[model samples]
Target chain A: MTNMNPSDKALVPFVSVDNMMKLVHHIGVEPMLRGLADYIEADFRRWELFDKTPRVASHSAEGVIELMPTSDGEVYGFKYVNGHPKNMKEGLQTVTAFGLLADVSNGYPVLLSEMTVLTALRTAATSAMVAKYLAPKGATTMAMIGNGAQSEFQSLAMKAICGVDSVRLYDVDPEATAKAALNLAGWGMNVVSCKTAEESMEGAQIITSCTADKQYATILTDNMIGAGVHINAIGGDCPGKTELHKDILARSDVFVEYPPQTRIEGEIQQMPQDFPVTEMWEVINGTAKGRTSNQQITLFDSVGFAIEDFSALRFVRDHIQNTEFFMDLDLLADPDEPRDLFGMLQRATQ
Target chain B: MTNMNPSDKALVPFVSVDNMMKLVHHIGVEPMLRGLADYIEADFRRWELFDKTPRVASHSAEGVIELMPTSDGEVYGFKYVNGHPKNMKEGLQTVTAFGLLADVSNGYPVLLSEMTVLTALRTAATSAMVAKYLAPKGATTMAMIGNGAQSEFQSLAMKAICGVDSVRLYDVDPEATAKAALNLAGWGMNVVSCKTAEESMEGAQIITSCTADKQYATILTDNMIGAGVHINAIGGDCPGKTELHKDILARSDVFVEYPPQTRIEGEIQQMPQDFPVTEMWEVINGTAKGRTSNQQITLFDSVGFAIEDFSALRFVRDHIQNTEFFMDLDLLADPDEPRDLFGMLQRATQ
Candidate 1:
């Protein structure tokens, strides 16, 4: 690591979307997800050092666009992400994102990255990180509810990080379930495509709900959950969106990534305002309990947070340092004479 | 322009920093500022239609980074900006920014522009717009305190929008004053470099403080002001940064953008919790009073609202549509099948 010298020629490495895809391809997906999970867990253990806030969102009739920003004194990062559920009908991804990492000392963007793929990786990595603590030891089976764009990453991350040996998947569209099953076929895990949510949860140690409908829909009921099962609730991530029944939330030992934000966007939104829940960071730090008994049920209400992206960026930055996968962007204007901003503009014009 | 058809291929126009500077050069600074002033005033008059919020800020030890987001339902916009006052000492611009405008229906970015240059222009335009409403009629003389990078833009904007023909400028660094004067030499306005703030304000109708220091330095005192003067306080935008003394604010009719944000970042921070200030939109909308008389001191305590940037993005988008000074950026991913995000990765990997 470089010493904290203020005057050192600071290096800000950026990976564009195309180049980032190349980097992922070079390293392979499973290894990248495992590495990202490790970084996320390590950062979560030191969560007190970060300045965090709920993402600021602007909602329109069609969808919502949000800015999720966070800083750790030395480096500041933010992602501009949009979620339009109906975008796929127009040949667009349901979500698109871009982000910037800046040097805190100068407030200059050192890295500008396409985060559409990175968000998928980071979100899955966060799920596995939470499951690493809450899920039963040597958990071998996972039930994936809703096989959409996020399904493949979630399946791979769970297999790679949590040692899941098989995944039972279900989606409203059988074609989606078939697509997920086909993707996971060569990954050395048993992929079981189920017809219903109840059938998917059979003998599963971890149940992941990542459906994309924008309303509160019950994908998992309390009766469907068995004891000692860890529920990775992922899709109920907005104000009006929910997945699990309130009974399931009330019965399980609920955990979340930032209590204030989770209260607004997580599955726990259906719970009472004064409902009790532990922050996932506390579990990662070992200051709070995860599962004390083999018979206890655990639920991790995972709404992606900025700190997870911060960790993912840190991971990508470190791994790509010795490689040429990063690109130098003309995002910040630097003048030879500090006061001559207009001089830089003048030179650029010429 | 495309008849607002949902299925039509809408043109996505962009202006890079270089292209924006060329546009400014081509259109002339006075006319560009005048056009921007018109856009800002029109947007401000319809403020209730906007989805407004206090900019989300991520503060670090060296400086602060902010995400300013706003929407008018049909279009969504946000600006990513950072301010590090000490950056100039390291040959970097103190503020660097970029912004995006998107279609609310699909959450697709319709325009992406470098906002560092546009921010300076829009900020000046906003100041001039507020001064047009709050300043005395036939205001021909102005005092510019802290003549730094933004001074020329302010001078040109005021000359075009408020008919200010002469400006008295002062900076702690004489070199900055010389630079400002040099940049404004042939701009058809008279520039006088003054030795101090007190000397600069003599016989001036508007007093603008755009200092760079990050502390409450009291650049303007109550004793330094004359009757009927309009103050366009530009700097001191973050917490712990202020330019006007409390006594000056106590006597002047202070106008702000958003009250909660202004209370924390604007010169109003120097006053009590219950201090009264008018939202500038109210005055622009004619719902509240502006300057009551020629003798009433008026102050526009601008902390730079998100709405102004929203207006600027709209202006840039429109102008780019009418011109050809932009490069198409593949910022979003288009998948043949929305559920096949992994397929795009798979194809890219191949």
Candidate 2:
């Protein structure tokens, strides 16, 4: 063993919330969203090369904490995320997250990052990327049904990736719609705050619904949808939570991230176990058809798979290479002699 | 949400390797080992109340990364550990780890700590704790078969928790034994360096076998162990790694932390599927027998479990209160008006 001091191998690159915000400003939010979309699209094309597993969740009375882990044969990534809807009323975030990426060859962590903001960016990017292939041709207007924490991100990602210029926002609470509208003011999008959900859907070719409720609440009904409109349903992510009506799901040709996970947590949880849903990776790789005709309705039922988080972490690990957007965290113990860890501790006194 | 500037709730207390070493010195190693033993014994007594699952592992050509998670209804804890035997050849640690503890009520992380040093402490403490109940009466000598990073900790923990006054060390490499013996010189124990494994067991009532190899190799054969001794086998902790001969296990009454995991990763892996084994928790809680006769041989088939790590994290979380040994990590994203996360990012630009 070499008698070296703690080296760079002992330090993990940690991206804090402040640094992550600075990174967003450094890259520009719209461009970063487009970048995440590109990375996510590339990973989706090689989905078969991933070791995929459903998230391991620990549920309690108030909320659930989950660990989502995935590996791409060379790199391993996992996200530690929690969902506590009751936290919102107590002035806390409903969802908070962080993530890590490690080298698969040596099993050492390479990056540790704050993933709450990144999760939002990646979720929105994934929605827009799927819509690029499944949405109606030249769809420029989207009816955003839930103007919550994820609404402004969805609006911006669509503007960057799918060339959408108009966003009609509606929320159950008017203040939420106003909040999203105020944030999107200077982002070069036509932000329209609507009083009712139906008014938000008027003349819109794409309808995106994202509502946060821990119940089986249908934010979108069957009669509200029109033909050839792509429905981006992102909020139905847990066992007892769904945003679209079953009739709406039965009519639309649905696409999902992973069938095993989406079948249990996505909008299709309300359907049978063997529900016919196309995997988005197959569609992105051209093995499956997407939006065959203008009259056919298509829906992207997203529950936020582990591969999206893996891609987002990959982007962060690459982008933070030569930037001052991260700090070296002394997270690993590197002893001078590998067999003398206790001696190293004893020497710490000197 | 309140317009607070990253309040304490958003910050997790992080203990780095330097801080962990300082903390070990601050509390003193022997006292800390005894303290950890107390926490682990307490948790094991209430083991049925915990949410236990086998560790999630990602295997590769050279190493493996594992996530061990458990919850005790009030707090949730998990450790991210990797074992890459090839790392030691490249002047790196064979094992490195970090862990987190979160509040079950809100799913917010409370503590984040470097667990490389802590895992060594807890594993040794666990072995000594098991020997305290299972070893023969007035047992004062221990034979340490593997003199690697864990040897000195095991010797010290036995001295602290089990009142072991002597330790005989042996290893395949003489340099490892010499290193352990040199570091353990002033620790108030009779440290003996032996040439062979048989000589290390001379007059010792406790035999601790810990060798780091990815394949099954019997460090202790059947005829080496005598009656009325406790065997702490901890190195055989993977699918193909084992340390003790099958005949030795067949003659001993095996005690295991978790049977399902031990059956796959412990010395009992070579035994039959329906091999009789007693849960250690039952022995600690007085529901089962331990060392009933002076001639009975008791073996602790210890493949480290999540509860022991949970106990160690709990010990750290409780002890680091009001101390300067930890730094605050801004790991969560808390926004004013929880639905206005985009507004928080927008305001950060100012």
Candidate 3:
């Protein structure tokens, strides 16, 4: 019943996981991460252009699922993501996500893509982006606490963006540390598996906490940190779930993605509501200082934000348009006369 | 990489729009509406069991898009919907939607279905459900103020659930009213096309206002509304949008799906913060009152809630299971070993 030609520009482009991986492989993960970081930084600089809201979350007995939606005046994007810590026991990833980007003018979805793998990449890219501005210059060593599915990306992105040359990894599970180290092999970085969280912090210029528990377990205490170290706190993203001790936050100049949201979901959730925190966008726009001195301690509270997904989706959509690795789904209905939606249904029956 | 057998009980069945329509045709719309009404009522009775949040909306210059998410302990559901009143000029539906139902235990989507048509159906069913409780017992005639794409569904659903025998229709566009009447020709209901809203409401026991305007246009005023008339105010949703006059809300005992949401989106938005309104579930569960007297005006302030879509998804999933019209989508990655997500990328290269 659609009158539009098959080559009409109104049709939406969809990218599945298989095609997304091809795009990553073609462009290389490091470059994709760098490009995504640039888009994110640009969007963050024009933060007033977005319509933002703290994500609406549904908490169950096992885990939580959330809908993170944001829009510029032109494009709207939302990510459906779930965090189930015990899912690994049931042979499932702790996090799975999918997202959509729609045209605000007509309110039609222009793109839909799997965001499971993309989230890992963007989270790492965001962490690395913060480190570029907040970390000590030429930081060569990083201590990775709770090395799991995310550890490899964090290590690689940090190395690519911040010139981190060595990673000391520690996890409650030795197998996870081995997996992280194995993934980093031949990447021209020294990987050391430490027995304790304290041991991992030794000689490290930056410390990244990526633990995956649903509770407030301090993976990094105040005593475990040293001066001039940038703490990329990635895993402590929900209320009652934190990896850094409160004293650690007290001693560091904390930077966050969105203060209203990060204060409720980031490690700062453990701190008072009036606790001091600077938004990372301020640092990116040069409105606020990032690393004032080489010996100063800084914390990047890495609770993911909607702008990051918006940037990643745009990047994927652009790359997919230039390539042929994506699939097109009949996601939107195209009627010869859109008012005759009923007629389209009747034709489908025939 | 999937190792699970086809007969695995852990499998989550999905029914797309094509399959869902086949199931609806097989069962017939009348019975399906009745079934969905039952499910919606059951959920509404136990509304306290749900985790409710006011929908997250992003409003642009042209239109508004919203994410409505809700969950019980077992199943989580959310719908992505948009309302662009001017979209019909651009050959697009005024409202388009899609939704997902996921298993809370594993955070995997069990069903993904198009909600454009289903939303129209469920919205009508929900209106009928509320009318059954709020309307006068022998209500036989409904004054449909706006004859748009949704008018036919509302007429049929009201006939099926509330024994509505006739509909008096009025629309700014007479062609839309003619279309509604033509679609309902065989539905065994008397259709009277009227020139004005005042003439349409004469002797009508139920008045349904489903007009599509993004401003505060008063489609119905207090002088036009009759005593004991159950007003199904459907279109006054989002900020700056209202169908009924503020005086009508002040006169009627308004009932809403969720108070926090209806406060911002429903007709109650015009009222004060402490303005008294009844939650529909409380009335359904017999904790609150509905139509205490025959002459008392009752208003169902329907901005549409997520739970109705959750029920609709559940209904479609259950009905489409025994049908063969669905396509299997490899949306979720099923790894032979869950920890081997990296292996999926490696295998894709080959």
Candidate 4:
């Protein structure tokens, strides 16, 4: 008879892509987005307790692979993500991700999950949650420039968290806008397909630019962003990539996730080295001001910090308990006698 | 019927720990170690092509979690590992690991496997391979200074690759020595258990010190190490952990894997910053001299590097083809249209 504890230690809960989608449907997307936003906000409130560091990145001419790790004393989490803009031309997703959550007490992995869907969810939840504090009061409209894989999630997250009801979608590729609009049908938002980026911004209190390209293309110019609108610029996330013009950054009150990382990978990378920016955690903690006046322009320059992923993993860990959305994977070697690893290998044949 | 192409893209091969043991038994351990050593040697020969960076680590008072990533312009791989010395008391392995190999062209993971067992195998293979090049000519006996989980693998690897026929084992705990000796029985090698570290080194041409503890430790002093002996000191793999006295290092020709990491984490952490050392890749590439004379003392200060893990993953990826040792895991979200991730999630319930 096989002992149970070694097998228990061997089995890590693995949330496959199918299971993750099932979990999403089980919880409902809107409620899951709201749950993610709540966890992110709570983590942000106690940000000082976290062990934060800039993501370790390995860059190539074609793309980049990054490892983002963080710990909060009790648990540790990390995401393995790759960003390749050229992948879409070959009928592949431009970004794919997987992540793990481990118990910090004994250093054994407890959960492993596909984060491609979860990252899109948490990123949108983060944008909407930030907009709740920084956007124009009672904001119900958003201009989503670049209607691609992330557009639907960003629109729905705003609808769920910040009560935004309408989305004005625009993309250079007209089929992208149609695709996003088609997928978001019957979900919960009024989605408008616009030909021009300028036309998409009509009557919108928030503008989110998430174009996936490797170049330093300015999708939004200084004149494009008007006063009192919060801009969520995420596509310009690596070195030598920025979406907004520098003059636009000069006019906006920029807030970032983590200063050390944001200064290198966010929209603030285009600005001067000493550019003033507020850390969003302090704003959420009430130590720093967010939106002071209706006429002030605000920009949330998110480069996807590690703490946000840590929070999302925590949310998934809490949700997968007593649920059938994950499989038990024997991903760690747990010998009956910890010192007899070879004996375990020998006994496997018996 | 649902489409299969998108589902194909979603699958990644995962080798669980149990399956890893089966794989080990299917393809015997000695052959696998030799294969891993061959891959590692080839990688070291072409080291310039790889993108090598120090591991990203998160350290707490309890332990450390590290992510080591490397790419050779074609394929990318990374390992997620944790080291917590206090874990054995809680019935958990002190070190547990998992790894992933990914395609760089489109940025998707190709394989995910348990590396705790693989790491032990590869670490032993590396030490044996190094001994093949640096140990005294026709060396047949080794003194394994720590009889823990790694002792049997190290002893056997030397027997397989370096022609060592006997291992004299020593550990502070007598039970550990007995355990290792029991495991190595009937394996065509003579194993001896010793009470003290000094007694184990009698007539041995190679000394492998792999004690497990977190401190400024000196398991071997200068007087204990004889001339022309190759010392494999690996147990002290982090800051404040050293297994050899500084005087012993001063008298030896030190070879290291990635000097930047070794200076901080290897036995050389106790040495001066500008202490002379040679990168092992240079030796493998024939650019540097190794063990030039019979009377010269050689010390291989090993603090495992990312390239070795990259090589180990490469070996596993090649071995799993046409083999029933791995399962296809749905770890990536692949939509039919690539952009309709929301639709993919929506259809999972049906």
The candidate that wins on lDDT is: 2
User: For candidate 2, what is the lDDT?
Assistant: 0.93
What's the TM for model 3? 0.93
TM-score: model 2 vs. ground truth: 0.98
List model 3 lDDT by residue over A206-297, tens digit each: 89998888998988878888788899999999988999889999999999988999999999998899999998888999899999998899
Question: Candidate 2's residue-wise lDDT over B198-226, tens digit each?
Answer: 99999999999999989999899988988
Give the higher-DockQ candidate: 2 or 3: 2
Off by over 4 Å in 2: A1-5, B1-4
Scored by DockQ, the top model is 2
lDDT of 2 by residue, A1-350 (tens): 43435678899999998889889989999999999999999999999999999999999888899999999999999999999889889888889999999998888899999999999999999999999999989999999999989999999999999999999999999989988988899888998999999999998999999998888998999999988899999999999989999999999999999999999899999999988999999999999999999989999999998999999999988898899999999999888677778888888888
TM-scores for chain B, in order? 0.95, 0.98, 0.95, 0.98
Lowest summed-lDDT stretch of 10 residues in model 3 chain B? B2-11
Candidate 1 docking classification: acceptable
What DockQ does each candidate score versus the true complex, computed on alpha carbons?
0.42, 0.76, 0.41, 0.72
Instruction: Rank the models by lDDT, top first.
Output: 2, 4, 1, 3
Put down candidate 4 lDDT per residue, A246-314, tens digits, no spaces. Answer: 899999999999999999998888888899999999999999999999999999999999888889989
Q: Of the pair 1 and 3, which is ahead by lDDT?
A: 1
Instruction: Report lDDT per candidate.
Output: 0.84, 0.93, 0.83, 0.90
> Where's the lowest-lDDT run of ten residues in candidate 4 chain B?
B1-10
Ranking of all predicted structures according to DockQ, beginning with the best and ending with the worst: 2, 4, 1, 3
Task: Please give each candidate's TM-score.
Answer: 0.93, 0.98, 0.93, 0.98
Clashing pairs in 3: none
